[model samples]
Target: MSSETDSSLPTVAVFGLGIIGSRCADQLLNQGYHVKTWNRTPKERADSESDPISAAEGADYLAFYLKDGIALREVFSSIQNQLKPSQTVLNHSTVDLETTKWLAEQCEEIGCSFLDAPFTGSKVAAGQGALVYYVGGDSEVLESARQVLEITSKEIKPLGPVGSATVVKIATNLISASTVQALAEALAITNAYGIQPEVLTESVASNASGSVLASMKLPTMAIGDYDTHFSLENMLKDSRFALQLAGDAGLETPGIQATSAAMEAQCKKGHAHLDFSALFKAYDTA
Candidate 1:
């Protein structure tokens, strides 16, 4: 098992080196922390091994940006027995509230502090060390980790106790999906009339219906190609996550339900791995 080699600098063990996880590991390294990186597929990056338990064995903080609840659960279950009281865990995955709260309870039993710290901004923001974190945990834990997390974030907001950050992440993604889909519908209607998208972009920019989501997606929609910042698959999961949360609260969210359906339809059409902004192409009447 790997352990902190240097006592002066903090040691961070990172698992699941996908886009967000990889960038966060780099940011921690840049901040002068001893970074131990691991991934299921060891060949994806140099110096990263496949043994997650060993990577986290003696780390001060263990961070993860895992794929989903099942994957995150498996990793945690594997290491839960080995976790030391001195370690803290920061989960950056976008999972449901029940699972996150369950993790909080489980980790607490093993004497490891846990934080649900899902985030916003894209791979672009990650590359630039400017992602925004939505955190949920004990207040003192959030305060202690704020500076370390800031190594990859422009903002770190504590929403409430465990599971709150996961809810906020789902809510924000639902809004974002609706915003992008609304812009797609508007552009498709304009295209039906032979109106240029440049004209539509200008109109939205000047109108009360304007939004950052629409503005950011305009250029991608105009070019008929997406850059894959956030995958349609991930966004679709967020849409479903919103519906599940609403159901748990006994609320009927018709708009979000419809939005989730649209997202599934787009994903079913093989756009699953593209930038979710490509949902605009679902409305390309031309």
Candidate 2:
């Protein structure tokens, strides 16, 4: 299960030089690993090496930070052959369970180890190397990737086999979406009564009902700054996936459906790039 072929630490090739991939690659480089990176958008190449196939050449770990399953599928065409049989591919994208499982099988076909290691936290955490990772794969494979994953994650929880990590990630998104919706509704109620947002936020922070969400987002709400940490569009996407999972399980999830609708409304209003706290804007404008 060891991805490294030699006595030395393995070289890593990261595909996608976006906020997440770039941060991961930088962390690997800082830890003294030879890191190679590539991005679909040529302009995204930030002085790091480029070319997906070239990056995979002789790499012991091939990590993907793709946006979704479709992007991952597309990228495979270019680098599938370059991936060595014993090398591991860590997929950090929040893709569906079925797709994750299929990707693992695909990697197995080529003699590569595949781990679904979807993450929570945003660009802020990525840059700070404080993201929380939920890993799913063979336990031995996970142990092999532990050192590298530890560099960029504050917590790395092994959830089970391939695709289980994605389930946990989607479940986490459900809670986050619901929390943001509840916070927005609560703030709107207070706003309707002419209560100061700062006072309400302070009281909530000091009360039993307060949460990490309130502590992290209240400052932005007080200043009416809805810049991105996690975007409404991304939240909506996650919500949809969560709801789909709920449906597959024959369970009810009206809250997720409601939150997904709200996010869609916000996105349609051209706030897609804004933080999920922008959900407040939908209520504020309504």
Leading candidate by TM-score: 1
Give each model's whole-structure lDDT: 0.84, 0.82
As a whole number from 0 to 100, the lDDT of residue 69 in candidate 2 is: 73
Local error of candidate 1 at residue 260 (angstroms): 1.4
Global Cα RMSD, each model: 3.1, 3.7
In candidate 1, how many Å is residue 215 off? 1.3
The pairs that clash in candidate 2 are 85-111
Query: Candidate 2 residues 105-184, lDDT tens each?
Result: 88988988888999987888888888898988889988989988887899998888887889999999899889888888
Report residue 201 deviation for candidate 2 (angstroms).
1.3
- The deviation in Å at residue 256 for candidate 2 is 0.4
